[model samples]
Target: MGEVGWNEWLSMMSSLAVVLVLLGATLFGLKKMGLSRTKDATKNLNVSEVHNLGPRQKLIVITINNEQVLLGVTPQAINRLGNWPEQEAVDDLNQSIDINQLEPDFESPSDSPGKFQQLMSQVAKRTAERKKH
Candidate 1:
């Protein structure tokens, strides 16, 4: 009985090893055939953003090969809406902002020149009043 049990245990281990080997080979084959998710396959393609427009519709921004693509996607289909060079998009964004507008004028009253400063001052006053009460 002891010898029989030892043989059965050895047989089960061998079968398990064979199954693991087959599984590993199958995974390797799938990866080589490009049917498995692999980093090399998507190294240059990136989904930058996704915005849901409805329950079944979305706007997707994807970057591929140094170009940005805008896609409109729904349950039924995916459509390319537009595309632009990534560098051109960066340049356009930089050109849209004026450096001078972002600088706060120090000579003016603390609250007069910038809305952010004014809002901060109002917040400070409210907090001071709250502390007094």
Candidate 2:
């Protein structure tokens, strides 16, 4: 700032100090008012009452082979099978027929390939090798 008369400088400084004090007081007041709502919200927060399970809910009740399973399932197990994208049920249905006879066939990644396609791949490899030479 440029040098001003002492009286003008003091007056300008006083005005600036007043503005800073007013701003601080307004901010403090807003924070004080906001605390009431914050306290009210805290009082209204939801609390899940996780207590002892009842008779039916205690067991995971799944019938695998005309018999019910008495073991309780974890939340992680339920979360894992929640989504069924693609033809996953088809996999279960496809394996249902040969469950006892060929259990090895199920869950195995298919390795079958067309004969002509394999021969074409070999020809392409030979052509690439000739180009390299």
Candidate 3:
């Protein structure tokens, strides 16, 4: 509550700097250990769809090592629901089957970038092309 003197202000700022450095080091360590939630998801284990049964229960379809497996996840544990047939030549751009038909319980939208983002990128590309021309 009282006004801080010059020395006290410098001491407080130094302490804050130390705390921030330690926090940054801890976050870097966590990222290196693959514990950061913001870390990119595993390339081999890709989530194809998710069905939320309740607040705590969900059925997830994840493609692991080219095989899709249905998983039932709860607060307690995760169980295998079933296995899906292997897809052929499927990519982010090309999908043969309708994702909605695969799961009736929940509507699974495509994971491709949103239409607005795509349109903006296209506009930017055309503008750059026009500038170059």
Candidate 4:
């Protein structure tokens, strides 16, 4: 390429400066509008639970100001399920599920059991056997 003259160099630098200014202004506008991801988006609400009903349906439980609400979500729309009532704390032992109590093939387990669930089941079985003896 031919040598860049002083005028060409100055023009190139001015163009770069204009681009930087526009980028900075866009960032500033997003921050002012509270649309920047750097700020905590869930400061006022907490997602307590989520259940997948089907490919396009989901159940989401959200907590805000110590109140919990259940929401049904689908591709088309969102609907309120109901308000979940807060319960008194219970012991962990009472919350434990017995593997033997689980129904055999309630649905096809091979469908969507992810790696984490598989590992957790293995761990739970080992722990339960250890507790038995």
* lDDT leader: 1
- The TM-score of candidate 2 is 0.27
Q: Which 10 consecutive residues of model 1 have the lowest summed lDDT?
A: 93-102
**Model 1 C-alpha lDDT per residue in residues 1-133, reported as the tens digit of each score:** 3456878889999999999999999999988887855446448888987765446555677889999886766555576766778876565334332223334334433232244333334433443454455
Best by TM-score: 1
Ranking by lDDT: 1, 4, 3, 2
Tell me how far candidate 1 lies from the true structure as C-alpha RMSD in angstroms: 16.8
Off by over 4 Å in 1: 6-38, 90-133
RMSD of each: 16.8, 23.8, 15.9, 10.5
The Cα error of candidate 3 at residue 129, in Å, is: 52
- Candidate 1 lands at a TM-score of 0.42
Runs off by more than 4 Å, candidate 3: 1-42, 88-133
**Cα distance off (Å), candidate 3, residue 34:** 7.1
Number of the candidate with higher TM-score, 2 or 4: 4
lDDT of 2 by residue, 81-126 (tens): 1122223433332332221332232232222223222332343344
Ranking by TM-score: 1, 3, 4, 2
- Each prediction's TM-score versus the true structure: 0.42, 0.27, 0.41, 0.40
Which sections of candidate 2 miss by over 4 Å?
1-3, 35-133
